[model samples]
Structure formats: structure tokens, C-alpha cells
Target: MGNICPETYPDPFNFNPDRFIKDGKINPEVTNPEAVFGFGRRICPGEYIAVDTLYVLISSVLAVFDVSVPKDANGNPDIKPSFSIGLICHPDPPKCSITPRSDRHKELVQNLLNSDPTNE
Candidate 1:
């Protein structure tokens, strides 16, 4: 928890959503709240929006398929990643795999695609 060395952190390392969740719960005690939100009042004014969006995103994902980290050459997911900083900090991409949980989901995706209202 001391000062981190940039040389040690990897760029575009493995992704671990559970890193944001701990003890089967979501709270500051679980992760660095400041890092998730920001430091002090200088934090993003859109914190509320961001939190709500995250809730919806996680809920939606959990309601559907299971998620996991991408295995490395040895078939393990032990990659720790770094982040980018600017006006805002963005997380590095993690290697992972995604697959539909059921045929219902597949059909739903197909239906949405088939009924695309954006079609000409």
C-alpha cells in the first residue's frame, strides 16, 4: 500500500472484476474507494451517474452470463494491470473469455439484431 512504482505495474494486464468486489460484497472496505471514485471534492461530479451506471452494468452482466479472467500461456489468470491517467484515469484491458450462458440469451441477442430499428 506504499507508493507504487510505475516500472512495476504492467500495462494492459489481466482483468479481475472481483478486485472491485470482496467478501461477496461491494464497499470501500473492499477496495480503494478514492481510486474508484476520486480523491475528495475534486472527485468526479458524475460520481452518482458513474455509480448507478456501474450498478446497472454489473447487475446486467450477473443476470446473464458468468465472467472470468483470460488464462495465460499456462492456463491461469494471474495478470495484474496498470491504468492510464489524464483528465480521467482509465483501466487497462484484461485478457478474459466471454460466452453466452444459455440459448435464451442467444435467441435474445439474435432477436435484437434481427429487429434492429437502426436498419435502413
Candidate 2:
């Protein structure tokens, strides 16, 4: 995993999906980041479902919300995205501003929350 990342991917820490696209197409030359799923016999069994779940979750969030870095009192963004290295590397509680994009989006989220079975 270390070999494929920070080397094959330029500025690996940043989320730059454009590396996979060139000339309005998915560049075949660049290595797919999904290699983290493992390769050959060590491949994960739940890779397909995991990828699908991520797609659904990401798309759903993007569809209803506008995500950005929270601005300071001076109207300057206070974004300092840092990662913590551990058993599993993850962002160190980066601040984000997620707001419903529109009234319809707000309603959609509210309806989903209201209809949630676990909330009963």
C-alpha cells in the first residue's frame, strides 16, 4: 500500500480525483486508488459492496448538501485538514460546514430523519 501511494500518487494526502481523468476520460495509465483493497489472492471479499456503499453515501451527501470549510469571523476559511497516523489513518477531526443546498434538500433530510425506524 505504501509503494502505490505517496509515490504513484502525487501529493497523496490531498483528495485529487483528477489524476484518474485526462482528456475527459479515465486515464488508464494512472494506478487505481482502489488497490488499497489488496490484490491477487489477498483481495478483499467485500470490495464490491464496500465500493458501492461508498458511492451511494458520497452521492447522497453531495445531492442534498453543500459541504465546505467553516469560515472564521473575518470570513476567511479556517481549514487545516490534518491526518492522524495510527492502526488506521484518519483525519484528525477536521472542521467542515455541511448545510442543506436548498429548501427541498432540507425537507428531504428532515423527512428521512422523521421516518427513521430507529428513532421511534
Candidate 3:
């Protein structure tokens, strides 16, 4: 996956989802979906469900939250991309600000959290 990542992605370490876009659509050439889910017999059985779950989670977050790099003591944005390498590569949580996009979004999220039994 690491090998193909650099080859397909311009900046493999950066969060550049636009790389997957081609003519306003998802470009299969650069989009390496197989990397997350194994190939052939080793492929994850729940790959479809997993992908759906991720799509929903990411989309929902983006709908309400304005996630951005956190500022350092000097008030300069600090962004150093780091990842954990293994059978499956995943990024470590970076210093960032996760605030609601608007007052309405904040209220919605707050209400959801307040109503959610699991949040307790």
C-alpha cells in the first residue's frame, strides 16, 4: 500500500482528497481503494459496509464541523503529517481545531449529544 500510495498520490502524507477527483468525478486511476481492503481471498468480507460507514461518518462530520489545523504559540498554523505504518496504515491524531461551522450546527451537535443515551 505504501509503495503504491506515493506512486498514485502527489503528496501521500497530506490530506488531499482532491487527488481522487478527475473531471469532477472520482478518478479510479489514482484512487487506490484496494489498499484499505485486502485483495482476492484476503479481502475483508465487510469491505462494502466499512466503506459505507466511513462515507457516512466523514460526510456527517463535514456537514457540521469546521476542522482545521491548530495554531502554535505564535498563532501560526502547524501541520505535520504523521502516520502509523503496519498491515493497515492510519494517521495519528494531529493538533487541530474541531469547531462547528455555525451556530445552527453547534446547536444541532449539542442537541444530538444531549439526547444520545450512549453519550452519557
Candidate 4:
């Protein structure tokens, strides 16, 4: 982004998933103390599970679906990728569209969502 919040990341542009992977090994940094789940010593005991779940979910999504933007006539994302600053940070939301890779995939997604009773 034009304005990089170095605090969110001292080197905001850098890929710092060091703890997630390093030397082709899962680094120990994040497993020690992280607030992504709860906080302090009394933090969620299942934090590791949460982390693993996130890894699986994200990996599965990217493996099957394409994540890109809604293209304009020129075949470019309608919006640019920029830095976002707030409680949670991300690349600025892009103008995008999502579609299953195939009818089978669509059905799988629909079935999963429809089967979820908690969804409204």
C-alpha cells in the first residue's frame, strides 16, 4: 500500500510465516506464545488444534478454488491489492468473484454448507 503500517509488520511487505514453516520445518516461534486463540497462561488449551484447523482449511480452499478478482474488460482486478490496517490486517479487499471449479465441486460446497445447521 501507499502507506505501510510497519507496526503490523516491521517489514510489512515481507513474508514472515517463519514459525509456520522454516528450513522446511515447522518453526517453534508461534507455538510458544500467541494470542490468535486466547491469551496468557490460561489461553485456549486447544490452540494447536485451532492452528492446525486453519492450516487445513486454508490449504483445502486454495487447493480446489481459485482466489482472484472480478476482472474488468481489460482482464484486470477491478480493485488493486493494497495494505489494510485495523484490528485485523489483510490485503485490501479486492473486487472479486468465486466459483467452484466444477459442478461436482459446487455440489460438494453446497452440500457442506446446507448440512450445517448453525448456518442462517
Candidate 5:
């Protein structure tokens, strides 16, 4: 009983996160993916914090970097993506490019690194 069911999520295998959005806001009618944290009284107590942290982390990364499929030697996108099945499902790392979105973003990252005491 995963959230990947076709009845609940159309074309669930495809990475269409925009399905959860409608009119510039999260669509309440869409099934929430919180089932991964369990259900009812047995639900993980840290779920809120975990989800919030993930939102912040992902937003931060997207703000600073441009992530996309990597180009092959011939300059065509190498877009093969697959996942491993288990208790915790996760995508197998695909060939992708992650670069700072701009010179300002790169400088911001450098400034962050320079300010970290542990980096010394």
C-alpha cells in the first residue's frame, strides 16, 4: 500500500511534483505523501520537523544550484533514472549536473564555507 498507486497518483512513476500544486498553492485534494512516516497513533513524532527540514533543505539547494541531467560526451542529456526497492525506497543516483545558479550564488556558497568555524 504505497502512495505510488495509479488510482491515487496519475503517472506516479514520472517525477511530476507539480501535480501537488494548483493555483500557486498546494492542492489539499491531493494525497499527502506522509504515509511513509506511518499512520494513526504509530505515526513518527518527528514527522513535522523532518518534513519541515526537508522542505528547507531542498528549497535552499534549488535556490543556490541548478540541478539537471548531465550531458554525455556527445552533448546529449543522459537521462536514465531508476530506483532501488526496500523498506526505504530511494532513487539510484543518476548522471546529473549540479552547478551554482549564478556567480552570486557561487559567492554566497564560498562566503558560507568561509564563515564555518569547522572548516578551518
Candidate 6:
């Protein structure tokens, strides 16, 4: 109930990261979206680590790839965000294209993959 509260977050249904930003910086007054990690005494202890790891992972991926919704035959972006209903909401396999942003990024990805010790 707290997660989707329109009073705390304007246009709650919309994916807007800008809501937390003000004057080109994170707004201190804006409430942190920490409800997913639980609340009160039962709040998740690993939430900080989890959020940090996610930030690193997402930044790394964005540095190498240009991720976008897959285009249809008519060249229209096919974007329909759907999720499975359950205890843990899981998003459906996205219909998207994750391609290297440039030749340099492609080489960087290839190099990293090739250097993986587990691949041997």
C-alpha cells in the first residue's frame, strides 16, 4: 500500500526516476522507495548491499549496451511491460534488443567474456 501511494509519489503507475531528483540532485525530502525491502523491525538487512549491487550491475550493462524494446516489422517499438502475479512479482521475459552501443563496447564485452576463468 505504501509503495504505490499517490500522495508520496505523483503518477505512481508511471516509471519516473526523476521524482526523486530536484535541482540536478537527489531530493533529500523525497521519501525513499524502501517498502519492497519490508518495513519496521522486519526490514531487510541486505537492502543496502542489494541496492548497491544493482546500481553497479545496471551501470556496467548500460556502459556496454544500448538496451531498447525490439522493433516490429513496421519499425514500431514493441514495449508492453507485463508481470506474473505471485508472492514475488516476476516480470515476463522482455522482448528487447540489447546490443553493444559501439564497436569499442562490443570488443570490451567480447574481451571480458573470453577472459572468463569459468569458460575454460
* lDDT head-to-head 1 vs 5, winner: 5
TM-scores of the models, in the given order? 0.57, 0.77, 0.73, 0.45, 0.78, 0.76
- Tens digits of per-residue lDDT for model 1 on 13-113? 44444555657787454334345555676877888888899999988876666677767699877567768977766777866666667899868767877
Regions of candidate 5 where Cα sits further than 4 Å from its true position: 71-80
Please report how far candidate 4 places residue 74 from its true position, in Å: 4.8
**Model 1 C-alpha lDDT versus the unseen true structure:** 0.63
Residue lDDT tens for model 3, 1-120: 463557766766776668888999988777665656667878789988988999999999999999988787998777777889898677887887789999999999999999999999
Once all C-alphas are superposed, what RMSD does model 3 give against the true structure? 3.2
Candidate ranking under TM-score, highest first, comes to: 5, 2, 6, 3, 1, 4
State the C-alpha lDDT per candidate: 0.63, 0.84, 0.82, 0.67, 0.89, 0.85
lDDT of 4 by residue, 1-120 (tens): 323456433564654556356688876643433554566778799978988999999889976676776677998556546778887776765556666877888888889899999986
Worst 10 residues of 4 by lDDT: 1-10
Top candidate by lDDT: 5
**TM-score pick, better of 4 and 6:** 6
- Between candidates 2 and 4, the one scoring higher on TM-score is 2
Query: Which ten-residue region of model 3 has the weakest summed lDDT?
Result: 1-10
Point out the higher-scoring one by lDDT: 1 or 2.
2
Count of clashes, each model: 1, 0, 0, 0, 0, 0
Cα misplacement distance, residue 19 of candidate 3 (Å): 2.2
Query: Could you tell which candidate, 3 or 4, scores higher by TM-score?
Result: 3
Q: Give the alpha carbon lDDT tens digit for every residue of 47-73 in model 6.
A: 999999999999999999999977779
Which portions of model 6 show Cα errors greater than 4 Å? 70-79
